[model samples]
Target: MSEHGGDRARAEAWLGQDPDPETRAELRALLDDPAALADRFGAKLEFGTAGLRGELGAGPNRMNRVTVMRAAAGLASVLTSRDDLRESSGGVSVVIGYDARHKSDVFAEDSAAVLTGAGVTVHLMPRPLPTPVLAYAVRHLGCAAGIMVTASHNPPRDNGYKVYWEDGAQIIPPLDQEISTAIDAVGRVDELPRGTDWRVLDEAVVEAYLRSLARLPLGTARDLTAAYTPLHGVGGAVLAQAFAWCGFPEPDVVAEQAAPDPDFPTVAFPNPEEPGAMDLALALGKGRDLVIANDPDADRCAVAAGGRMLTGDEVGGLLAEYVLRHTDGSDRLVATTIVSSSLLRAIAAEHGVRYAETLTGFKWIMKAGTDRDRLVYGYEEALGYSVGGDDGVPVHDKDGIGTALMVAAMAASAKESGGTLLDLLDDQARRYGLHATAQLSVRVEDLSVIADAMARLRESPPGELAGRTVTEVDDLAEGLDGLPPADVVRLRLSDGGRVIVRPSGTEPKLKCYLEVVVPVTSSPEEARTRATGDLTALREAVADALGL
Candidate 1:
């Protein structure tokens, strides 16, 4: 059969099997369009190291009810086989949560049904909630597994399913691969069992999550009058309540993006990292102490204070210092992703704490922390932070709501010290030297184009970047410092500048992260000029290497 014909056949089979008329009609519509069919059924959605994520549509390659059910079945199988999990939970149990994205609830339900049919007990959250809450629920409820349906900050058309183990962290290594194997074992959706015994989650579980937020160290309620925006995602209710629980004054909501809307009508993309995602919040926050925002799924956070929005690196730096100062001992360990700013390392070193750098994801950091009990905090450059120890507090996963509350507490404490967050940042720079980080992304319509660019750069590496000699080249794909292999390349410059080039695992773009360090005595004007010049040179070299 022709490729298009095969696609049509597959889509038609799905439509015929679908019980929902609405979904069947949508699938049929795609069947008639060659391009749509190819996009939908070109391949089965691969469960990568990051779990399952893709555009929502009626194809094997998409994140639809059928695909979600398959993933859940696979996860259930993995959970059932684990002796430790079975003994703890009595039976294999999985907690599922979802966001307000299109079809997210339906997908979550589908996963629950699949797990139920597999003889695994299922607890479904009563309504859409933050990703962190689901992460917390996994450990709090003592379930064998957990699932969250969200695309996080991806575009409106996208959705995802992330699986977490009993520890409330995203599945890592052997488990991820084992689940993928089980998912691949089932050849047809009809082969899976169907059941209806999945239970709606207990109200107490969610209540407990809220109660935990109340214990964070906010100094006083009077010092926190802030602005908040959920970016038309699922964070509003949980985050607002968390702030209130922490004794923070009610925040002024950005009316436009206050509610959970799958379409994300007010923003181009539901990501706080995107330009203009915080415009409404910034406008509404004019006179407030700070502006806090969460992405679609509420797993990441962004903060703006004193009329300036801080980058993820800036926030990470501040949080790292705050957590360190709060700790009494010097034996703490601080961890960050390799792509993040190295200023945290300087702070750790100054405090006589150990600093560790993981590969690019929070999963690695979480695992590293689990292996070492000394870990106090871990953060990535993408606005994800795990405060306290990996096994403590809300969850091991990245949590925006919890982090925001902590920020409020820090702000309140800073006020008591007769200074501001900016003042603390300045002090950090004075002690650690000045470290500034920036990233440049090159977008492309076709993913293969990015693959070609990576191939070209690897075949012929650049000798210099931004007029600085490349002092060393570390091909992460070959393994670095006893770490697992990853698809990344790091270029160390002769000056205290470095560049990291890697393709985004979850998106269709190439990312270039640049970090430059200047003496603390240098004026801000001089430091910025030097960084900009270095960035421009690096950009040119990247373009040349990619032949773009």
Candidate 2:
């Protein structure tokens, strides 16, 4: 049969099983357009460690009810099959949460129905909430698993499903594979049994999560002025409540972007990392002591201070220092991804704390510290931070609300000392030798473009970057320092700079992480200028090497 004929057959089959009439209409609308049909039904959206994330539409290649129901059934199958977990947990249970995204609530409800039908007790969040709340719920309710419906920083047209195991962290390795295998075995979504036995939880869970924030070692300093925006997400009310509960002043919220709007009309992309996403917040925060922004799910945080938007590495370093200062560092662990700045290692050494560098995801970062050492803090370069305070991680995931509180406390303390976050950053630069970091990300319309770029770099590695000789090349695919094999390439420069090139797992982009460290000889400003220049050169050289 012709490819179009095959797509038609698949589309007809999918339309029959798809329960969402909107998606069914979508499929029918594309029936006459072979190209559109091919786009919708050409390939199934792969369910990997990140779970399912794609544009919202009909067919298996998109994020629709059929795809979500299959994934939920697969998750139910995995939970049911895990006799060890079931026995230990007493019963199979799950907590579901969602953000204010298109079809997010629908997906969450459908998932709950599927899990409930499979004899799994489902405790669903009463309304749209942050991802961290659900992560906290998994452990708070003692459930076997948790599911969150969000695309988290993706475009407005996109949505996603994130799965967390009993550990409250995102799934990794065998579990992701196991769930994927079960999803593949799913025959028909319409045939899957769904139950209305799931329970809609009350504000108790949200209150519990907020109460846990009291444990954050934020010193008694509530005299901090700040501007905040949730980027048209569900974090606004919860974050405001968290601030009140934590004794900090309620932040001056950006009214336009405060409410949960699925279309995210203000920003082109609801991600704070994207350029101009924080423009409104920055404008509102012009004279404030600090500015904070959270993505659509509020799992990741971004900060702005001293008339500048702080890089994720900068925030990670600051938070690491703040956390270590408050905690007994003898047994605690601080970790960051391999793509983050090396400054965390230096800070960890100075603080006498264990530090780990994991592969590029929070999945690996959360699993950094052992049961003995326990993860006190973990962060990645994408504005994701998990701060455990002196105790243990309340939310075993990146928590923007908690991080924002810490930032506020830190800013308040610095203010009391006649300094600002910028001054503290200078102090760190002076002590840690100005560890500057930057990223060169290239978004692509074609997946093959990213693949070709990686292949080109791997085939012909750069001999040097930024006038410095390449001292060492570590093809991360071969595994580095006991890390699992990943599609990444790291190059060490003679001047102690480094670059790591890899494809973004969550988005269609090739990302290159660049860092250049310069010792503060004369002043931190001078060192920063030198390091910035070196980073610019390195960025260009990396772009050239990648043939971008």
Best by lDDT: 2
Instruction: Supply the global lDDT for candidate 2.
Output: 0.91
lDDT of 2 by residue, 110-151 (tens): 999999998899999999999999999999999889999999
- RMSD of candidate 1 to true structure, Å: 2.3
Worst 10 residues of 1 by lDDT: 386-395
Question: What are the per-model numbers of colliding residue pairs?
Answer: 0, 0
Model 1 misplaced stretches (Cα beyond 4 Å): 86-89, 219-222, 389-393, 445-460, 522-526
Q: Tens digits of per-residue lDDT for model 1 on 368-450?
A: 64444566778898989877622244567788988888787777777778766766666766677668788878888998888
Q: Number of clashing pairs, model 1?
A: 0
Clashing pairs in 2: none
Q: What TM-score would you give candidate 2 relative to the actual structure?
A: 0.97
lDDT of 1: 0.81
